[model samples]
Target: MLFDTLKVSIVLVTAVTRWKGLETRFLLWKSLPSSIDRLQHFASSRMCASVKRCDLKVESPGFWDALGNLEDGGLDVVKKFFELLTSFPNLATLSLTALTLDPLKLQRVSEIHTLQTLIIHDCRLPRTFNKLSIRDLEVSGNPTEMFPASKEDYGLASFFDLNQVERLQVSKPTWGDPLGLFCTQSNSPISFSNMKVLSMPWTLSLSPTFPSLLTQCPVLEELRLFSQAPKTPSHSKFNQSGATTLHPSVAPHLKIFIGPDVCASTFTSRSLRTLVMASSEGRPHDIRKDVLPILTDIAFPGDLERLAFGVDCLSDPLLDYIAGSFKSLKNLSIFISMVDGERYSSDIHCRKMWISRLSSRLPSTLIRFDISTRFAGLNHSEDVSGEDLNVLMTPLSQRCKKLTAFTMSYQSAARGRTWAWRRSERTGYGSGQWVNTDEGVRQ
Candidate 1:
């Protein structure tokens, strides 16, 4: 079954790649000089099996990209790689699973205007491919030197520009020089006017006024920024010339803001309705001062319907502040993890105080309430009784009379946590943890 699953997945990926147009370039990596034609026949045989079973189209060839193992050698066979890309004029999506793009070859590949989605993992683009037009992009690789250093520098940037992209996903070791590569700089001032959904890791030094550009997206509804900063402190000066200050123009139509890291406090979006500031590390100052204030100060285009606060620690002041933020909060979620405490006893007191405070103020306003706990104690013997959990969540049940969804879970039981809320008529905990309404665990 495992072997069959692997085979089926590979065939499906190959089919999707071929459909999106990635066939010829894929053949290049499989065929060697001595027996290229015969190997092509073998690949055709495998493909024919799928074609016979299901309807498959193969009218035009595509850039089938399969990077050779780098341990064998480093970028010595790039000429052959380019030969593969040029074979397919209609290649739409190129998947590079390894860090092995020859700069010149990437540039040549970019010339194919039919390319729509460029999914790169570990591999950097050839120097020539920076300015190419790819609408949907996903990149996962090391942060060190991801972008081509200069316009003349033969690397990733030479083949592509991300300013016009509609959907983008970037997960790297860190966010280094985001504006220089992803956003526009002074010399390369560009606009992602059509960009809608963006997901990236956090950085303290993202280019200036980049936050304000969120207003530029006419239809942007979802924004998720994951935390990627190191635990150690590093104070770096923000260069004045590199800063892009937010003025009036930005993503005016944005509706959902999902920030998973510590961002600049100056972010302001008038149309934002759902704000999710989720954190695994509970920092008191960040929630009480930085994030919560943004929601209270700005006025949403519509009533701010949903709000969630996810952190390792739950504080009464933060809870009070959140209760005062909006008059029309429909859904609310809080995940609290204890910080360096021996037992759940000390944390429970703090948690109860916050929960009680929320209960008093949230009766009329809140429709849904989600609260979870994370107990500390390195030993595996720790346990949380069901009665205790019921007692803890008791306040939420009483205060939120209009509550459509009410949930609570114990951290000791939910260790190594990965859970979601179940979607039933009223409310249900899908995977064993707390979740609000139908959105499924708040992104």
Candidate 2:
């Protein structure tokens, strides 16, 4: 799957091609307005040894400059680019960014039966959901960004049969504000009957577009909500509910959920294994209120193999809950940040117990454990000594016999040290610590 920047995605594209990720990553870094035509031309070229790659470069001084008047002929380029797909009979994946597609053009490309995965960002699509038969789709940008004003197009209601898509990831709106999922709600034909995995921004959960969208994908195994759950006017009331509760009867077969607190306690899923309940995007989580009381309240707690969350400060109860809830954990990552210049559990003994208790609870099946703690509130770096960090990591690394890697960092010390597991005569204790010396082959 493509690692889309606008989407809360990385793990979703694991089933697709390696080239597919690169194709999508390229778009995430920059718009490919000029690359469209050049990509089409490169496939037909045989004499690359004598050809000048510079000719395929963008003719426009900048991509933005090409947007209006000829858009550096971007529209014309994408029109011709569509024809290139019909040439690759076995082609199954296509990732494009920053382009536009009219209704007829979208229909023409949809006819490619071999296509099964489509990853696109910042592109204009047909007003209605046309018959695009892709199984895995990662999309952003508003549907109305560049759509034509045709009466035949009825927005997302006709984007194709939603049941055909098994995996879906959505990030930013195509353009401006989102198209609101669909223009007309009751008459919409969208369905997620076969959806197995879905990743979207947290803010969308509060928007009107999300309410109807969530109920449709009941078979989803993983649901990831990335980025900050912004306090937008649409769903401001749900802010206080962050990391608090899970909806009952939601995705009975769900194995992963990484995002903010959705409403209700109908969580009947017995297969959930990964739960990351916090605001990501590197934002500070407040210690004013207990950020994790919601952890104990999850309907079917425990049995999670991977867990992650944000915290204002470490506490005995919080660490204790983790040890009791998840016993067979393999991968764990924690995001710790300061809130308003102070640690919540500031007592020296409390901090030391947090380290010791946490160090003992790490399971042996664990391969990777990452803790990113930043003492942002302290006035001096010395306030958080390196010795304390060592006390925490050394035991964690040594005790977890199967650990493959671990990292612990403090904001004061910008360059966090990393320890990786190796097989042979590596520079480390009998176990693993990534000895940086120029010793035998480094692992």
Candidate 3:
């Protein structure tokens, strides 16, 4: 079975090399149909060197047990895996998803010379996650609980210097337990001076000095701060927190800022041209209008081109204020969170009033509009008809003469699809190319 999978992989690889026009992607792990225990049978010495990239997920049901018992001599199986990785001196990307590895095994893997991208998911940083000099890095999923309880200092932030990390994504800590999960007690800011693109959950307690360090990243262009449920509040604030001053234009190179549920007022920057905010059900209704005024008050050197609002908040004033404020705004996006029973109001008048108010404030410079909502109370096809969606975007769409892209979620778009499908064909009103397919689009 193992030999057969390898033959197929090799054949597919050849096909990929031959058919340059093929748009489909082939996933070896999914296509390979053999138990991992027989891996040695497939990866002969010659083939080992030919493999360029490999992903070894630790969460597979019996994988850890197999790797841990690699030698019947214990742990050597993992050692052999590294041996294979080292053989591929040209390896570019290695992704380990939802896998846990022994620390000693990681230390040995770090010795490999030519690794460009390394990703670890739901895995503990084995001093090696830090020691490697990979150009791209991604650490996702929940923080592991098996880490030592006494050493919270082992948090990922302390493990490495992210100054050279180009694309960094430290996803939210879903289950925070066993103290040392994702943080250390330093209370000082960590730095990512060379990070070009950063996507971190809002709950991350950045060191107050983080902004100062960001200034070092002269090439940094995009910044995304996602708000996870708040982490233990940090006592540090701007002035009272005795920390170094945060430079006003530290992120001067930044052109985009995407975040939701964050008090936009807390941010002060001069280079931001694209702004995205995600609102949830518990969000403050007036935050849009309240925060927009403050955000606009801070002068940005560049023209604001795109503005997006996530639908967690029920307030329409926020949308209205945005339309009225940034006259140079080119694109607008609205994403609605799933409404709970309490938020569901049958009164169409209230809904109409909200839409009309938003429509009245539409800005003339806008070119693209995206509006989406998750209807938790009603099945879109069963009860809510498509007209509802048409009405929803009608107000915003009618005003933007340059409107080119209009996107909505599957359910949200389904409601608007009936009308939008037609309007989109006539006026090119369909969701943008990105709206139909972008991971974590709303969140």
Candidate 4:
């Protein structure tokens, strides 16, 4: 019965691809021995010539035991598997999950010169493999299991030795002294000369050596710090004085930063063009005081083009401060959280008035504006009316002449809606559209 099912499946796939004149460009498989035979047969067939990306995930212990049953303790079986994989001339991206990498087998796979991106998750790497020519590499593992809490792990170092790696993401490493692995203290630190983007997990950002490590990536253009949500509702506190100060000598070309609020005074990067202040999910609202000082202290560049704020930080006073601070700002996104109550409703009305006056209050150079609101429907209230929409759109159209794109969106537990307004240079004020369920307006 299993043999008949396999034959039918193969025949169906063959018929569909042949009939449509299509070639498989991507493939993902989750099981070993069972899928392995099919994968081998497919790769050897003429239809696989177009395959350029492949993902293989092996998490079952039985699969490894199956390999053990093969001759030469499964090493030859692994080698032959990779030998077939590298035969695909066009394969450029490969991802593996929970599969132990054999150095000898990887050496054979590394012969594929066209490979550009390699991603490995929760896998063990051999101490050394043939240097890959890939330009992008991502490695993720549990830090506690991957690296010893006290000593530097050379197992981690082997992957960084590839000079061709231009982008790197290290996530979920155990917090104890992992930054030391990137420091130059040993063997004149590894220089990622071609690295243009680097993303580190949040726990690593709190390390004292973080600033020093940034200094090493002279050409790094973008930095992203991914923070985990706290277990409690209380927000994390950052001392204004304890922020890391970046010297001009390091990462001089850095232009984009996305992470937690840092004391603006601590940053000296004149080339900064974009700043994103990340917010934790499920955090308490109205923590404006915690973020206000950071915004006020940051010496934002005159040419800063984009700025984003967390949901609870866009108070009236902060908006005024931003309007005055970033004269060259072109894109702005603000998130507001509104709850149902008399006081909250009044606050929303005041914010609506403030938003209507953005044409006069915001930077003249602005080209795009995005405002999103999360409405908590705790009390009975009227649905947003057409008149309210007109009040918000008219001033923006008349006053903000350079504005080209505008978006306003609202989300509630019951329903969600979005409005997009665009102005063309030729038609001027008369060109705009409102989109809603069963309702559409053109002006």
Candidate 5:
């Protein structure tokens, strides 16, 4: 079996180079022509030029039907495997699955230059594969008609040059109009100006040119957007007849924002500090008419620490506007359900009166609290005792006296049971359990 998996990968790379003196830089070869001559003798060994990192999965079809009987059909064995990965020179990082290169042999594997991180799945690239200068890039498949059939066609606009990409992820399952691949058509403007991090794909969050494609990522810290509904009443009537506008030169150094809850008030980051919304099987008056008027017309920034939502948009006037607006908040995550209808009601004193009205409106500079729920009328004729989880963790440990950490999880809805609890304010003590589906934590 591939020489006993290369003799247990040379005895786990000589016991991890004799316990971490370091040598094996990481490599995974799943179906590369059954060890293509032992990976061309470890790519001309010298310990394969100190392999930096590599993952290759060519999904064997008898190695492309033996290169369909040769005749350059195998593109010279994929250009001798990118000329043996440009002789490693501290190989940066590469992952390719279901490979299909030849964007002129990926410009000779993008002139190596210590290739910085590239991940591709269901591949096909070659319109000079955007002259790589990779600084982290991810591309997922199903790229509709590989875009650009006009606007003087340069679709994927030479993969947007923000001085050689800082971080970009492009997923396609028909990303229809990613603002025409980030603008062009005599409306010239393209800038990712040292893009920090961006993850987008729910077909570009139902594009109405998705808030003008976050004004071309100007100093974006982190942003993730994924969607599977909401926003289509003609793009919520062109964002309430204003024909779109989030311009504070969008994402101006935005600090962490995750998508969907209908694009949470189309964003206006005052250097936003971590906000995640996600949750939509649509209709709760279309998420309180498109995310409660952009969360009552955005103005969040008391150095907002972290906040996550979804308890059907936690309304009580959005938890009294997030406990009277984030007083330098400190990590809070929530996703509730308890399930019993008329809009949630598995009553345990109505989920401890919504966690004692969100622990008397949060902020005493709280510290780490995560809550997840499901219970949906529990099941097996209801059960959750231990005083219904101490009536939900004694009003969140007596309204957060600088809580060090607290987590609660439930999930019963019959035949999918789970229960968890944890507490640790410097181990003042707390723990609970009942999770197992083929054995997973049960104490």
Candidate 6:
């Protein structure tokens, strides 16, 4: 039912990162006075029956955010909007960015009993009157202690109650407090007792090592350490200081790891099913030495069902290791940079070399395969054109019979082209087409 009145409440979300600048992204919510009018205009549409997700952004006088801005408009508008918002029957997600809420507004937000996911970014804190019922949370910035705090209010309820969140995505944990999202004012460390999925960016150097964090997220099943940089992250202080390798008992139930080379090699989580690693090209020459040893040590024979690797170079030993180890693998993506020092051959070599061997070595059970040369900066690149895709991916299609979808990407700021093949609609096995990537990576 909400689909019929999408624009009334939905912000036609676009890729903020790729947008021209802050001005372009927040065109809808630029500043005060007009802020409420813009929102009223956006939500002025006739009410819908049931909405599943709600995304709102608000901030102080000096504030500006991506999707829109709600600055200096006062709390009255926010209060009025949430009043109408909380009446919705099935609201499940609330993403608030750059908000500078005081206690009254925080109490108003706490009244939304149906919220299951809360995403807060670059916000100043305002302690809430009610405990949060969110099971999933994503925080990109600190909900720093807010302004206008009474001298004695520092001892009030914890900034927000995150103990109920089972799936947490964090940017920095700021010591062991999980960015003070946990509702504890004491000096004791918080336990993420119900946590199953934890994702952190490579820049998380707030406090504690991976082991210490894992101790809190004892039952964490999926660990994601994604980052904007494909090469070794410059701020990898966690692994540099001592948490270089994980002990099996730390994240004992860990089944999926998607990030840098914090080796699972010691013994294993014993049942690691999906390992998607972006090689720390701190040492570009050791594609064989660094990755294979860990794969050889931890991943059980025939256990890995999906594997995606971003490597300095694609090597025989690595491909051979994958073929030998992940017999049941169903989906695979390999990103290689062919610059001499960057990794494999230049420009994913639009020539023959590894294409033939990669095709032959990939497991028969794989349903989808993606291979590409993803270099940042669009510079010093010996590039390939879209016309070269067939010559590049044809060998793969011929060899891997089970591949229902195949994608080969050569994306840059300007080119904006992406090529792929999917099972033909008529035959259900051998047809597909090219598509343009949304918002050019360079834009």
Query: In candidate 2, what are the lDDT values of residues 44-154, reduced to their tens digit?
Result: 433222222111112233333323323344444445556555554555666655544556657656866676778766555545544676688877755555344555535
| Winner on lDDT (1 vs 6) | 6
Give the TM-scores of the predictions, in the order they appear. Answer: 0.57, 0.68, 0.59, 0.68, 0.29, 0.72
State residue 83's C-alpha deviation in candidate 4, in Å.
1.9
Candidate 3 TM-score over all chains jointly: 0.59
Candidate 4, which segments miss by more than 4 Å at Cα? 1-49, 59-81, 130-133, 144-153, 180-188, 229-249, 263-265, 279-302, 311-328, 337-349, 364-367, 374-378, 382-387, 397-443
Off by over 4 Å in 2: 1-80, 126-130, 149-153, 174-179, 183-186, 228-247, 262-270, 280-292, 299-302, 339-353, 379-394, 412-443
- Which residue pairs collide in model 4, if any? 143-174, 264-298
Residue 360 displacement in candidate 2 (angstroms)? 1.8
Model 6: lDDT to the true structure: 0.57
Tens digit per residue, CA lDDT, model 3, 1-443: 11111211111121223356756543222223343344553356655555556666532343233233332443333444555566554567777654355555565457666766777765544342554455677776545432334554656555545555788766655643212333455454455566788766644424443454455467778777665543211101112223234455556676777654243433445456877654444442344354456556646623788776544444545555565567788876655545434544433122334544555666767666655555555444343334555565566566665665554443443342212322455645643222233432342
- If both were scored by lDDT, which would come out higher, candidate 1 or candidate 3? 3
Q: Write the per-residue lDDT of candidate 4 for residues 38-91, one digit (tens) a residue.
A: 666656656456777766554334433322233235433344456677767677
- The clash tally of candidate 1 reads 30
Give the better candidate number (5 or 6) by lDDT: 6
Better of 4 and 5 by lDDT: 4
Question: Candidate 4 overall Cα lDDT vs. reference?
Answer: 0.57
Which is the leading candidate under TM-score?
6
Model 6, runs deviating above 4 Å: 4-48, 59-75, 143-157, 172-186, 228-245, 263-268, 338-351, 374-399, 410-418, 429-443
Badly placed stretches (over 4 Å) of model 5 are: 1-34, 37-94, 97-104, 107-156, 159-257, 260-263, 267-386, 390-443
lDDT of all the models against the reference?
Answer: 0.49, 0.53, 0.51, 0.57, 0.56, 0.57
What is the number of backbone collisions in each predicted candidate, taken in the order shown? 30, 14, 11, 2, 2, 5
